[model samples]
Target chain A: MSATLVPVDEAPAPGASRTKPRLAAWIGYAGITAVLLLFAFGSPFFLTASNIATILTQASVFGIAGVGLAIVIIAGGDDVLNGGIDLSTGAVAGLAGTVTALAAAAGTPGMVAVLYGVLVATAIGVVNGLSVTLGLRPLLATLATMGVAASLELVFSQNLKIAVTGGFFEAARGSVLFGIPLVAWLMALIGAAVWWVYGKTSWGVNSYAVGQNPTAAQVAGLDPRRYRLASYVLSSALAGLAGTLLVARLSAAVPGIGTQILLDIILVAYMSMIFSRRRLVSVVGTVLAAVFVAALDNGLTLLGVASQWVGAAKGLLILLVLASVTLRGRKNR
Target chain B: MSTIETLAAPVEPSPGPVAAYSGKKRGTLQASRLVAPGTLALILIVFSVLSPVIFTVGNLFGILGQVALLALAAIGLTLVVRAGGIDLSIGVALDLGALASAWLIHDGYRAWVAVAGGLLCALAVGAVNALLIVILRIPAFLATLSVWFAGTSVQQLLTGGGAPIYLSAPLVPDGFAVIGRGYFLGIDAAIVNAVSISLVVALLLGITRYGRKLTMAGEQPSAARISGLRTNALIASAYLLCAVIAGFAGVVLAARSNGYVPGSGQAYLMDAIGAVFIGATISRYGRVSVGGTLIGVVIFGLLDNGLNLIGLSFFWQDLARGLVLLSILLAAVVLGRAKSRPATGIFALLRTTKHQALTNTAKGNRK
Candidate 1:
């Protein structure tokens, strides 16, 4: 996976030259900040430390899942055939939660239950990876996995919400350090680790190379398929982790839980691209975008807006970002 | 002016993998074209053995009725995919159509007017999709997905918190009921509508210049553009037609259910996509066709009917369907790869390079 294995001249450049003003890249951050300020001014409860903590806690699930999705998109690139996307992230999360909840109810140790849940999700991810590397389109491959995972979730949960209480659940739901939830902390740690791995490691560089142009990467001696497969695995594993945490936070494994927030996860991942300097998906940007989305949802709720409006607002926001990005790209060209 | 001449020039059959694959035998049947029908027959045989009730005329009609809406939706999906785009928001159009028409009928509007209203609403969605993808340059996948996300929320708002709008039996107009349940020539009206629509689409795509150009645009947009084909306009029309057809399906869905069910149309989204792709395996070069999509829909309908008849639980049915879809796709991919590979020769090298160039261009156009 090392870029150094290929001669420097043979490798494709990492990214296009940064010609756009730095201000353009900061639009996403500015938009999030403006929204936060609007909420603070509009609602007295919005600025409270507790509310901030709640937003972070709420954002953790999608933040963790978004990190994985961002990696897949970055490594999958923009090509229609090879571009990586995992439609099963939400289903994987739901299935993992179901597994953990069922195992815990069966008197399994909390750690082992979590392990079982993650392993099941990871195994499904392997299937997805194999499907894509074996030449099935990424969209179709993940879509098939999504269906299988959702059905499995129903089978395991018996179409009923399985409530789990005790050891791990109690800790996950109740634990807070310095007024911040444990899940939020875990999300941050995962994001930071991924950022380092994606930015500072040769594996990360090679993944970018592979995404940029697979044929070129092949010519340069990098195995693009391995990186693509690894990206899917990482995405699903993180989704599994998010699902386990979601179950602990909710104290129940609800059927179709992951599917409910799938749009938000995808939105966070895609929106993060607008924040990156090179318009690529990045860990830091995804985490930030997730928090912003969670905060928007929280603020809208506090303002007594209907949940439906919040969903519509998110869709509109993404469209606005996409339009501006496209227009900007055209102008630059 | 020059562009018009280029467009008027009769299209020369493209020399590519598709032509190469089909060239050797003009009159002979392609084995790939039988995959879907073969799978359908296998399912029919297996299900008939598993359940005594499967062969009953009543049950067979029931399966056809069940597949009608799905067939319409998948046909719509096929057109969009053939025009080089995906429409994830088709369910949105379907739901909106059902809701709008149901609301109108509930308010005592004439059946025809209500149907028109539903289709209009769906057409608006198509317009938004066109603006995003064709005008604003958003990728079709993301654009349609956004519409789906926003559109579902709109449906919820209209329904006042996701409740279904039920039309009581007494208020149900005869015209509306006829669309869904009445028989025409001993066949369900819904089934009749689906069949006719499928035939029309088949003719439109297979015989009309517009249809051929749309397929050409999808397969090779750059070449289409060079030939003076209005690819953007063709793509936009495809989306519009897809939405309208899906909207019609939704209207029938509403009439059949005697109300607008808020999320019922969403159920068809994945199934429709699965059907279209499964149908793709039936084409020599993996192009989608109306006949193939119909067969795919029938296969799904049979699985649902047969599995339920066998007393399999709902979850097991779902699992079975998912596995079936996965195995079919895997088989198709493996078969395709094997067929394309050549043992040795300069001709093989040339073929491989041509195939690579086609794929690369397809990828570039999609971006």
Candidate 2:
């Protein structure tokens, strides 16, 4: 496909050196520190240990989803035209949550309910993979799935919130390991595993190759199509996991719960690009970015700002990062 | 026969043997052209059978109005897509326009002034998008997405935390009423607006030099820039025009609803995108066209109205719409591939002996 020939924005040229990436990483760290310090000074509650843990817990759901989005953006690329994005992430999450909640309500075991949710999401992911491999644009294909999933969420949940309690739900919400929620620990472990795989494994390297230049990857004896499809499947599966976790945390499967966090997932994933070496989206970067975003949200909420306004603040921050990167690129050119 | 001839004719003139080859290819071209209209006709027939009220004058007019409002946004989206960019913030422009106008009217401003203010607000968003994309070099998708996020917050702030600003009949100016409720020459004003806007956009894209330049800039930016075309200006203008047009749709929506409902314009975003892409199937090269968008809008409007009339719940309607869109997209892909390579996969197995012979003959003639 002609799309395979399109170079992703984050794909550094062959033989590019490491110095610039180091400098970029430093800049990203500095930015994060600056924000944290600002919040610390802005509100007394922001620096409290309990508030910090609260932020981590709040970050866990979308943070895990952000990891999946980061993988897709890294492997399949983030370009809107030729590259791909999974618009169905939030919708899939929402559907997964509804399915899991419904299953639990029907007296299914917790593990079984979770399996049903993730499996259903994985099935949708397969459809997305089929569509993209069949030559449909990823944006539009995922958009179709998003609509379908959202509709199903509404249909299955009957447009009402489904309360889920006891067993796994309560455990997921209440259990803390070392002063942090279990879900937060799960997020960290997933982040660490993904980081290791992406940084040290051949599969990760091959996926990056596919995103950087699919034609070259094919020439290198890699099946770019398979890799791209796998990335999407992985993304949707993680979204499903995140959805289940979110429902557990909320103790309810709210109709549109997944979509409500979509903006945050995208923001965190894209924000991670800034922290990644050479601006390539990385799992470690995504995890940190997620925490950073959660802190910002938490701080703003404490400062009496509405959630939607915090969303606006995040949007503006992303624009700033984009503008800075563009300026930097121009200067280098 | 003439319609078929026009549809079947090659886009560019060819000589001698090539003309004969094109004549053979004409069959496939004609079939491709028929797909959208044929689908529309099938939908019309099915829906009319399903709901007797579908054919009623009032319901037909209602469908027309709905189509008009949707077309206004889809057409604007078509322009941006044609310019090689996607504007995710089209809904933002729309909502801002609606909110600005409605707020102005609520504050006792003249309806005309309020409408202009709304348009200007939308245009400002376009200007910002242009600055982000053209100057800062951000991708259109992310740039407009941020705008959409920020714009939603702006709307919330203006509406006092997302409350709808209702305009009572007594407070509604005659100009506003005419815009929403008035008829002209036995046609609803909204339909008139849609038709005229469609005509003007068609002329702009089809007949104007600027439009041609914009299309070229979108299709081949580097080539256009090398040819001394101001690609940047053209692109910027495209975004600006897109915002203003979407803003106009927002105005109409506000008038129709007699209030500025926060995020109401967002309801059109996905549908408008679906319509534009569905319309792309009509073009030989998959270029977006104003005429095609109108057709898409009509199809969507009919489906929405028909599904409502069928007494399907809202969730069912959403599912149906999504499935229909997916099917259309998949069908377009499958049919396009089959036309190009008839001896492929399941399609090859499905072909009858007579059809196979015909395709082979066509291939031989092309060769």
Candidate 3:
């Protein structure tokens, strides 16, 4: 899928212009850092090292999912026709995570269990990819995927939350290095990998082109469909990994877990796009925004606000950010 | 606007090989055959084979009664779809209506007041949705999504952890039950009531000036605007009108159940969307119609009842529904494309702006 760098205007995100994006990314990061520092002072327990670690870990789970979502979003062309949103993302993750737990509980090796989980998720992801390329409208295909994933979750879990009954999450939750949870670092690693791919590779640049203008990409002799397919497959695979991490965090495979977290994942992904070099959705932006969201959620919970209301707050926050960004764009124009 | 103009260019010849295959009348007939009744035929065959017990008129009416609320939601959504827009908030909109009525009824209001309050809530929901899409200029899907999120939150706040509103306390009038379970002559009141609402919508779509402009605005927004139609208002009104009907359905559901149940309307979302889209394929106009939606509703109603009668668990039922929805959608895409090669919003429901900044700024520049 890697295309030779052809230096197209639509393909500039991965190379020569890479240096220009750093400044904008930092500007966004600065806001998030300030909020973190504010919370550190405002909430008595905010600055605690454990709490900081917890927030990062929480953000990382959502961040991994966000990475997949951001990639998929960036892979879509304007003419993609309501094609980019994937409502089934969380469901896919939950299924993968539950399968991993179930596999581990049945005495499969932990590594193998994880492999099995990822593989199953990849298969579903491939199906999603194929559907888009095969001319099923992205919205309907993904909506159907969501339905199937949700139902599959119900069938597998039998409406019950399944505990791993083994050491599935022990390493995920217990292992830490350099003052950060292993999972958080894994999230950073994946984020960096995605950033590198989009910033340094031709295939990544080609995807950017396809997203910008599929006709131009097609005329350039590039297969936009493959890129689109790859995007869905990649997102599904990442969602699978997130599902496993989610199980690790919860120590159980909870049915319908995706329903709760999918929105947040999508929210963080959109936030990442908003906060980043608005022209492009970047990995750094997604991770930073996810962290910010995690901190905000943690801060509100600490203030004794009900989680239900917090859900509303998240939705409102996204709308506010989106509106401001849009309004600002209009003003500039 | 150019894109919209292209869409509004009165039914041009399709651009591909399929265009050369079918004659005009034959192709139109073939496309219409695949929509609503096709789904019904599919359901009737499979379900009848699976469970002959559910293939009866009694079961049919029972299924209709069960899906009355869903039919109402679909009818509302049909208007939105016909306008080249989609609403993801219909489920929450239903909740808003039910909660509004519940609040009024619990406060010792008469049944009529509660019903009025429910309709008012629907109207307000429609207004808010209009402001979001028309004034704020967000895409229809995202606007409704925002409404869904905010409404769900407000609903939670309103209900305080979503406690059910029991009508047992001062008792809802016995006459209220008629809306859900009453009989008119030999037919079930719920079915009749739902059908009557569909009839009114059909008349609006078929004969009224409002309907004409709405069809024009959706199928050809730029053309409609050129002809002095308030396209934005028409789109917003479609949403508002949909919400009001959904609200009415919620009230009836509240009456039937003897209380207002939180989040109960969520299940209707998929079925409503499924019905409308499927309805379009089977529709003679290949546009949204009350008749097409009614058939789709009956199809869905039967599918659910049959699936249940066959003793499939809820999860299995959901899986079946999902598969059925996907297949129907896949077929719709193929048949629709074969009939009209134009790639319009009707087919591209969610393919709007993920990058709101670009879409909005561009839209502003055009204006």
**Relative to the unseen true structure, what is the C-alpha lDDT of residue A155 in candidate 1, on a scale of 0 to 100?**
90
List chain B TM-scores, each candidate.
0.87, 0.84, 0.84
lDDT tens digits by residue: candidate 2, B1-367: 1211122121111122222223333234624445667778888999999989899999898899877878999999989988878898999999998888888888899989989998999999999999999888887888998998899888887777889999987898989867767799988989988888889999999999988998888755655776889888999999999999999988888787888888877788888988887787787656778988887888888888988998887887667777777767767766865576433221221222212222222222210
- Return the top candidate by lDDT: 1
- Residue-wise C-alpha lDDT for candidate 1, range B305-329, written one tens digit per residue: 9999999888876677778877777
What local lDDT does model 1 show for residue A135? 67
What fraction of the native alpha-carbon contacts across the interface, defined at 8 angstroms, is recovered by model 1? Answer: 0.32
TM-score of each: 0.91, 0.90, 0.88
lDDT of 3 by residue, A178-222 (tens): 999999999999999998886567777777666654544555688
Give the docking tier of candidate 1. acceptable
The fraction of correct interface contacts reproduced by each prediction comes to 0.32, 0.31, 0.27
Off by over 4 Å in 2: A1-16, A20-25, B1-34, B341-367
For candidate 2, the per-residue lDDT at A237 reads: 96
After TM-score superposition, what is the CA distance of residue B137 in candidate 3 from its true location, in Å? 1.3
Q: Where does candidate 1 stray beyond 4 Å?
A: A1-22, A79-82, B1-34, B342-367
- Candidate with the larger TM-score of 1 and 3: 1
lDDT at position A48, candidate 3: 87
